[model samples]
Target: MRRHLRKLRSTPAVVLLFLILLFLLPYDNSFSPRAAIVSAVPALFEKRWWLINKPGAYPVDFSQDVAVLVKSGIGTKERIPSWLQAHEHMELSDLLLIGDFATLPGQEYQYRDQRLPVHDVLAWMIGRGYMAEDLDHPRLQKYYNLTRAIDREDVGAAQEMSGSFGWELDAMKFLSGMELLYSRFPDKKWYIMADDDTYLIQPSFKRLIEHFNPNREQYLGNPVGGEDCRFGHGGSSIILSHRAVSHLTSDREYLATAYRESLDETWGDKRLAVALNRLEIYIYEEYAAFFNGERPRTSKITKERLCTPVLSFHGLSSSSDMLSVSRTFEHATEQVLWIDLWNIPTSDKSDNAHLPKASTSLFDDPIYDTGHANWDYVGRPDEWTQSVEDVSSVETCKQICREERPDFCLAWTWDSNEKKCHMSWWIIKGDQAEGRTSGLNVPVVKGLVRSCRP
Candidate 1:
């Protein structure tokens, strides 16, 4: 009986020793504790864990299936080489710069040591009978005279003529450019048209295009007008699939009508939308958030667009601004989100970084005392506003912003003259306004940023 008891005690000790050895063994072995524990979990959970820990990386070269057309004019053509330099890393397969006038047949224009074959869409339209000189209107006569001056290398005369009729010529570039693109590179899966001042983010643009079928008709952009005459804002950017291009260009009778209509239309983008509506191709309203009509500094970062990918920014007319934005994302390894734009510095001398990083704490609130004078943080249409009585000051304005819900108030502006307080749900780096003061709710903004993190 004593021997049996000793055997039982010894068996318990042996099992404990085996367990300790299993845990201490190298993890590479199948029987090792770490490996065993990992194998016991479900495959789905394991995949999610791997995804969370993986590096954020995207493809660098995906422009083979895409073609980008940049609209320029003789006056604004000076910015072309700089724009090209900003996007040189894209290695685009076909990037044609089209304007109101074309280069001589078999001749290319030289700018800043770069040779680019510039197409004259206006000339093409006249050749195909899509455009004719209206003796009564005199607009076509002025356009023809300008082209002739350009052909003769008379820079002074061309510049002077364009100053007066530049806007009129701009309306004609849209359809003519589209026709030129269809005739030249119809095989491309995607076609993107942008103004000289527009900046396109390549990674996000590629992601957006990949989401849709290239063979189907797709027209997308930032819708600006009402439902009656809705169209994508020209300055933002316009995207068209190969099928959409074919629908518009295949019917010559419709093209002629569209071209004639372009002469009377005030905005080319609206005219293009009208032409597409006839062909049953309307704007893709669902993806409007991807396109921004404002530059980075002035873009409104709303909660609805916090996590959305940004494809383009308009009004980057300055070469330095374009270069600055390009450098900001040149080395980006992941997709550029709207939330990411908040991090751009507000001013050249400002060491303070924007969103995703908390630059200040509400606890140390010094902004109220030295409120931003002569500044306006523009509010959204649904923003809150109220007039204050008695002591109407910046402190009173900021207090109102603080008392509101975090989601409803991210910034505030005070009108000193009217003694009114305006609260905005958006975080904007505002512009200058006399007799107004503005401030931001930094803590709330930081909390919002934290909530959006992966």
Candidate 2:
């Protein structure tokens, strides 16, 4: 099971609305009339928020406000206009980023300004001065030294790497970057290696790092495995904890030997995997779920119903796609807050929700199969499930149910002792079964449903 979702972290506007509701709403039975007025206040505010900030209401058009604001260097209350402003001042300097860049100016320099600040923040592992005829240039020597330091003598060729040469150059970049970054920032807690095409959501990445222990030797990223070794996908992103970096750097000669062996590999990720395998370290796979590239394993349909927050989306080639995804994520976060805080119903949010809510179907049996084995739904929890704490009041469960399809949310159970709320499409029978689960079918919420649709 996933850790409890941090849905309570909401936008400032939602927080203000909650504060007003908590204090201004009458809590006493003595003030019955006032209480009735207070109850209506939430509904009114919900509509107001929906009308102003609904997903469809604010289209992702960068030409409108984003361009104006970005050009003027005016950031919203939550975000900084410039990439460096948001991170350069942060205390988490212990983390290092190593990004690979190609020699071509057409692709590399074209999007330099538009490139996300995530790459500029850390040490970029690239051969900047290799284009010059003189190999003895200080910059070229630095590049040469970096390649040698990483133990990949096959990579630091004096000539520019073009066409098919990219493969070997990329592998050299990865090994060189790891060695250089470790040598530069030996005490750093985490290191992220990514390609120039990769886009990262830095804030969410920080949250991921904060949630885990960096002292241990762990690797996090999208898992791409060959027959022999499984490594974090470099294109998507690869995260190495301090211990992992330390382990790799602990033996200089051994690292050099491994690097030499991996020089023949086409893919840098595969080469890294080989090194990790030889080192007897396993890669942790959860980060891959969060850090997606061109192919997203998780679909849009299931992502909403589940309470987990998506950390990043990779493989965005164009600047527009990058900006769009970034804004979409921000907007989705706000929509979730409105849904949870205002108890907005999930009406036609997905095909699953649109297909008969099980309430209106006359012939369809609304009741769930009562007698099933323990854990009737035994698969892993996806984005379609929600687990809240202390949903003892049916009202609370009904509120969360509105965020999903009425038919899909078959039942909900609340454990008083644990104060855990487990919602499922599956419903079980019996008075206190193996688990402290309880609740009615989706039909019970038909009258209570609130539509988010226009």
Candidate 3:
């Protein structure tokens, strides 16, 4: 009986010893020590932490409050699948896809298994006599020709005409879509209008709008153009509170005036702003940084933007780029700030490894191999430029960047043709230039990153 009691006591000790050994052992594909620990003590690591680690397992759904509208055309219709794939995890309440083509009223198209309601701006215009019976009307000629070209399925003619007349169609689409959205979902608190390429960071966007009153008229986005004609850059994602949309759509006279202006305007976004300006609803310039006009890889990670939560990224070149960005932030438990983008792994092979956390490291190393050949960091207004004696090579340009005060030089680009080296105070991932090379001051960037608020 005493021996049996001793065995029972020893069992608990043996089990404890086994657990200790298991935790200390190196992890493999089948098991992770960190995950094991998390599983063992569920109370210590909260649900938020667990969800952060397991991406796509627990998605934040904001379907009740907001509706997203994607503005696209037949030319870009193929991109819709990728766009849908990117936002698959975001449980949006209503996603309406609008274009310039004609569709029967209440028609829906099945794409990638989702039955999406289609809004045809062209059809709406025809029904409303905007593309009137008297096709000879000076303003209606272009619309008439474009409609004829589309009807005949003349791909070449349609493409050519669309290049010139598409802006007008797009403006009409935005106005009509707004009205339709209000009619379909008048209860929605907010509506977002974005291009097919634009990627909205749902969590950050939700966080931003939550602070504002949906009942108030709000027009918000990344403002562009002059103050007189300032409008939200459409590709950057334009946001409208329910009241704002109501005001724009409810006023028929305002809509007519806006449509007339659209015929003369070259861009739809500008026309939308012009229409709203008459109603005293201007773009909320304060939150401009939240609506980025650049893609993740090319976005400028300046000091001013480090702590700001990113709401959307515009001008993503491909669907793959969108998917990659979606994967990068899929598991984020908190709002994704601009600073967070800097640590994104360069490639899939380094998926588990983050770039060394940005910190104030004193070591000044001009990472030579990091220079991108045939690429240039475009000069900003605040950037410094100097003529380099050794125009034939990029070495001197790199040395100049390294020698400058860390605060003054975050990145440098050398132009072979101009024989000039430009150093920017902020880090801007620029575009390709045939005869240029660009590199970064790593240590200075680390310091800049460290300066941002958590």
Candidate 4:
């Protein structure tokens, strides 16, 4: 009996020990569990960071370029709405769209006027800081009345508010636009923002912009001076610069914290202007020049300078006629050998082969490569834009272009800044052996290669 009891006690001890060993043992699941984990890692290896402009990603090896983006809301009718109404869809251009802000609650704005540079109306909102007491001001009531006057129909507040809302919102859009634009083209030097209501006749604006202290990180529209700048209004229409706009819109919280109270208080012109200006941080008071410059007419400084210190702002209060003028210019757009990608002539390409040459493998080359686009073994990037491998047969190339929806694309010179495909159609030939030095008269679809603007 003594031996039996001892054995039973020993059995309990042994079972406890077994449990501890089992717990300590690294148990895994299925097939040699350790081998399964190793194999699983092979599948995980396929995922990787994607980089554009990498030698292994694009056909041509280069980076950097500029982009011109427009901002407008089709609150109403169609001026030339297919791609962009800002420049009227002219060809040979660099244009991007900054969505129309909440133009109209219902998408239909008071469409009777395209000639008014409504931007001028914003002047009334400038200056001033929101205060706690102004909540009872009678002018606030009037401004709200004005907002209601601007738009009629159901939904959202009519112009019951003053320009403060618009100004703040514009600042938001401007800042957001800059962040997004930079993200797309990490190396671009500047961003030019334009409006749809004006007549920007300065074709050399970019060159002039570059000429001005290319090293200076920011610029003003057209510099002007006025002792009364604080109490006075100045500036031509153009407001140029590259600084972040956060400083201008960051302080709306004091009044903005309570919409019901603040909206009712921002009425009187003087007080309202003070509150708004407090939020607008101008890089330079150069705005005064845009409004009070020596030349009232459009200034043409030798392709490099504006004859007048200030550029003209013709589209205020009346832009319809000017818009018509722009349309007339569009008619003159001619297609003269500008499709660079469509194999110009060998002589032309050799003249400007500044770009690095890239070799191509047939779509399926089979010779240690990830897989050829044609020859499943040649190792060029699958994402890179195609560079010409052989141009001996020009007619065959043309045939291919025609068969593929007759789209003629401008040759893209890789931009290191933006690190994406960029084509400068605004100034280039299309039919040359290599590329054109002029614009082309292609269908809107053909214009799809770049922006549909001249």
Number of the top candidate by TM-score?
A: 1
Q: Give the Cα error of residue 51 in candidate 3, in Å.
A: 20
Instruction: Give lDDT per model, in order.
Output: 0.71, 0.43, 0.68, 0.31
Prediction RMSDs, each to the true structure: 14.0, 19.4, 16.3, 23.9
Candidate with top lDDT is 1
Q: Model 4: runs farther than 4 Å from truth?
A: 1-86, 90-102, 105-134, 149-197, 212-217, 228-235, 244-312, 316-320, 328-454
Give per-residue CA lDDT, model 2, range 1-454, as digits (tens). Answer: 1233344454666877866666554222133344345445544333322224323322332121111001000011012222223222222333333332222233221122343222211123222321333424433344444434334434334223322243444554565567666676665666776554444544345545544456666677777876577787776677776777778767766765655554456776777766766676666543344555541212221212222323444544444444443433332322231112112122212122111222223212332223122322212234656677756653565456545546566555545556655566533222223544354443443323223321
TM-score of each: 0.76, 0.42, 0.73, 0.32
lDDT of 1 by residue, 1-454 (tens): 9999999989989987876676555322334244444445323122221114343232223556777889988877777766787677676767788888776655664434457787777778878887664434566777888988998999999988888887788898897788788788888888889998888888778766765666777788998888677898888889988888988889888888888777777889888888888876777665677899888867787765655677888887778877777776655545577767756665633433223422333214555334677876554334243334443888877877776544577777888887777777776666678988877776666565565453
Off by over 4 Å in 1: 1-61, 104-114, 133-136, 348-391, 404-408, 415-420, 431-437, 442-447
- Which model is ahead, 1 or 4, in terms of TM-score? 1
Clashing pairs in 3: 63-93
Candidate 1 yields a Cα-based lDDT of: 0.71
Q: lDDT tens digits, residues 1-454, model 3?
A: 9999999989999988876676554321124354546546645422222113233322324778788888887556666777887787776658888887654555465544567865666566567655446545444576677768878879788788777667666766676677667777888888998888888887777666765667777788988998579899889999998888988888776676666556666677888887788887777655676779987666776655655677888776477777776676665646777766656665633443222333343223344336778876534434244344555568777777777545566677888887877777656545567888888776656655555531
Candidate 4 residue 226 Cα shift, in angstroms, is: 1.7
